[model samples]
Target: MTGRKLFKSAKFQEVNTAVKKDGAAIFVDKEGQENLIIDNPYAIRYIHSYAEDTPFFLGLADGKLRGTKCGACNYVFATPRGNCQFCGETTKWVDLPLRGKVHTWTTCHFGGEAFLKETPYNLAMIEFEGANSVLLARLKDCKEEEIYVGMPVEARFSPQPQFSITDIWFVPAGAGPGQRSKK
Candidate 1:
């Protein structure tokens, strides 16, 4: 599919509500009220450097896990480093399978920005197979007690306009693959 088609698919459009005049996108929960701004100009300009890892980010949006690997020393870097840590070599992006296990997680009760109204949600670190790396993201569709270290997890993408592809989140395994549970 074309880039626009891939982005306009039902799944991609699910988390978004409307695009604003400034190119910022708004996300709304089931109640139809705006929950967050995905692309506020002030925030975007400051965070745009994070977009340099677009390939890695886009892979997440496409439901795949990816990392950067050093060409010189074959070192794998997680979280899309601009350069390899081991050999100071320029890194190349590589795809990884979307299967992993939870390393750790926490429930945030307060102190996030207003955009994230869903406080007390579970945030987690997922360690994918065959890579000495972990992705910090949200754990969806599962309760706090249910999330345990070593529990299998998978990647899920949240489509927010003008945001990096790393906007991906994780949900516990057996929560029904690729399905969004009702909140």
Candidate 2:
């Protein structure tokens, strides 16, 4: 209600009058005309099968990072893969080092629903010493200007795991939570 206006998309459905009301929304178009939008919210429990990627999520819960290694060609992946792209061979699970250097990074001005509260966050592609590829993860405890190619970083795990990628994030090598780089 300040100088800015807030607008959000909501689920629209035919509402039953017999039930307790949810609410409604007002949408303002560029023309400054207001339109009524019906809001009918419902909770859902969604299930997904990770299949071959199960090990990666499980490892995150255990405060570890899992990558895949090709036995036939010695190809290593920072991102877990079921098969090797180079040799077309089945890959085995391997542990990735906790510390890595930033290969590249970007500041996210926008993000998905799970990350909305963390808008304007930093994401980086981390390069491990032995891994052939990079892993994309959220970079915390530093501002966009402080992040650069080859910036040293270390992994931190969520104490309570949700079995999601958000369970693992990175920070400047020695930076703890709520600590920002001096740069």
lDDT of 2 by residue, 1-183 (tens): 323223434222322221225354455556666555554678989788999999999999999999999999988999999999998899999999999999999999988987787788888999999999999998888888899998999998888889889889899997766553321
Flag clash pairs in model 1. none
How many clashes in each structure? 0, 0
lDDT string for model 1 (28-119, tens) is: 44555544445444543352555557777666666667788788987666567878877788888888667688888887777458636776
Report residue 172 deviation for candidate 1 (angstroms). 1.5
Residue 87, candidate 2: Cα error in Å is: 2.0
Listed per candidate, the RMSD to the true structure in angstroms reads: 15.3, 8.0
> CA shift at 28, candidate 2, in angstroms?
14
> How many residue pairs of model 2 clash at the backbone?
0
